[model samples]
Target: MAPQTWLITGSSSGLGTAIAETVLRAGHKVIATARNPIKAAQENPQIEELGGQWLKLDVTSPDTTKTVKDAICQAGGSIDVVVNNAAYSLIGSIEDMTESEIETQFSTNVFGPVRVLKGVLPFMRAQKSGTVVNISSIAGLDGLPSCAMYAGSKFAVEGMSESLSKELKSFGIRVILVEPGLFRTKFFSTFVEPAAGLNQDYIGTPLGDTLQHFKDLDGKQNGDPIKAAQRILEVVTCTGLGVGTEDMLRLPLGPDCFDRFQTKCDALQENLTMMKKIAYSTSY
Candidate 1:
């Protein structure tokens, strides 16, 4: 494959930073976007040192589209791949979550990617080739006890990506949903925002237990961000692990994500088999 230009969101740290570094090291041009490029570069000096260009972007803001277009213009009006990786988790039970918190979660996780896509699709459509990689979570496939809003946001991304894969195929645009399990990222530590206060009624329930589990699993997650980033690059470039299998819609990273994905498929299959009669009965 030829050297491609990659535009990645939230490239300050975690998976985004890893992906930017990996892409740059692979001899590709990377336009890494973050809320504060100067601060992000200060923290992760290797990004710019590796020749990754930093662009100021905040996915949650309406200005995201303009920033993306400006970056595209600055990059000679061409963008080959876009990785939508900017998101934060709002962990808490449905009953314990506030309206504001839910809005914030969707604005960042769901709408953020949409905003970026809107800006880049025109150029991609003209080029008739591109890839859109959405960084979702295993929670998107299976709702957990204490991850209502976060799961909801990822679920939206999953649905949108699936539909977009079909919608964009005719235009030579590929959509991939990267469903990752717990990776050793600040996702669990600095990025995971808990609800304002836990509801006393659910403190002794599974929701509380789930919250505790996240705390315990913070730094001990089994997935490696570096390997995950490499796999993503390979998939987008259609090389390495992506060769001979370019039709994959979802790339489940880590053994944990694979196991969970299989479980979800099995459960859905069993339910459909048992409920097919009821489903048909409802059809006119």
Candidate 2:
């Protein structure tokens, strides 16, 4: 495969860092962006040492979208792949989460990707070929208790990616939604907790139980970030990773993700079967 230039956001740690390293090792050019480039270099020196460039980018900043586009133009004429991997998890029940908290979550997870896409799409359109990889989660497909805010953000990304895939197909741009189940990354450690003023009545309910369950699953997740990164690279390069064909839109990373997706599909099929006659009669 020919070498391609990849621009990955939130490349300081976790899957982003792993993906950046994987791309560099594969002989591809990587432009890794983080909110604090200095800190990123301090944390992962291998990124610069291994031939990847670093850029300071906070996706929530008003000027960041234009800055990223300009930076890409200055570094290289065009980028072949754009990875929207910058996002953090916000865990809490719907009622427990404040409007501010929910807005901030959407700002980072949903609007951040939108900004990157808006900046990169013009270049991709002009180049006539490009790939967009959006990092989502299994929560996007099936909402879990106490994960309503995070799930809402991911669900938005999934829906947007679906629309973009069709919209940009004629321009030779492909959109890939990566729904990872539970990777052993800094995700749990850095996840945002619920705000103050908790309702005492709901402390021991199912939502509370779910919150505790998430805490217990933090360091015990079965998936590996490095392996997940390798698989993502393989999928983007069309290397036949046993998951699906090259044109597949959604790539679920872990075994847990695959199982959850299958269950969702089965449930959907069952519901459709039960409502087939009513739906058909209404359509006419």
Candidate 3:
């Protein structure tokens, strides 16, 4: 695989920063983006030391997306990868969350990547060689009760990525969805709350497991983000076609993710058998 240039959004901290650092350490140039350029720069000295470029971009903003794309195009003439990683969590049941909460989550997690993909698709097509990496969560494949907004947003991303892979294959653009499970990130700490009029007590029962996951993972998340980032880049840069889906599709990182994937697979197989046993009336 040839050395590539990576453009990663939300590079101020956590997974995005980890991705940028990994790319830089791999001797590839990176375009690190954040809503506040100065803050992002200040927060990531490692990236700065590595000479990675920084840009101001709020993924939820249409105008910013366009400008970031234009800037990227004007810079290295082409971008090898675009990692859409700017997103936040909204922890609440569907009814518990206000309209604004849902809108805000969708804006950042769903429409943000949609807007970035639109802006980059033309350039990637013209270049005929690029990768679009959408950072989704395990919640995307399996629903979590308290994370209705997050799950909905990630489900949108997963579906979009699945269709996009087929759609862009002819254009030489590969769409990979990164499914991370219980990574140690500030994402849980920053989750948006229900409206002021709403009661926080709703967070106790139905949302119990969801809240516990966050608390349990506070300092105990088994997912190492740095290694996760490097593994993702390695798979994306892998050579030849025979190695199969690892080259250009869903990449689930970490032990927790692996376990979840296996569990889902087993459950799916069991359910399929059960459905087969009851297919008589349904088949007609």
In model 2, the Cα lDDT at residue 106 comes to: 97
Per-candidate alpha-carbon RMSD to the true structure: 1.2, 1.6, 2.6
Model 3: per-residue Cα lDDT over 136-222, one tens digit each: 989888777677788899999999999999999999998889999987778777777677533567646768656666656676677
For model 1, residues 225-278, the per-residue Cα lDDT tens digits are 999999999988888998865799999999989998899999999999999998
Candidate numbers sorted by lDDT from highest down = 1, 2, 3
Cα lDDT of all candidates, in order?
0.91, 0.90, 0.82
State the lDDT at 186 in candidate 3: 82
Instruction: Tell me the tens digit of each residue's lDDT in model 2 across 174-275.
Output: 889999999888887788887764467667987778877878888899999999999899888888583465688898989999999999999999999999
> Where is model 1 poorest over a 10-residue stretch in terms of lDDT?
190-199
Cα error, residue 242 of model 2, in Å, equals: 6.5
- Relative to the true structure, candidate 3 reaches a TM of 0.91
Best of the two (1, 2) by lDDT = 1
**Residue 261, candidate 3: C-alpha displacement in angstroms:** 1.7
- Arranged by TM-score, best first: 1, 2, 3
Model 1 TM-score (2 dp):
0.97
Per the 3 Å backbone cut-off, how many clashing residue pairs does candidate 3 have?
Answer: 0
The runs of at least 3 residues in candidate 2 whose Cα sits more than 4 Å from the true structure, single-residue gaps closed, are 240-244, 281-284
- Candidate No. with top lDDT: 1
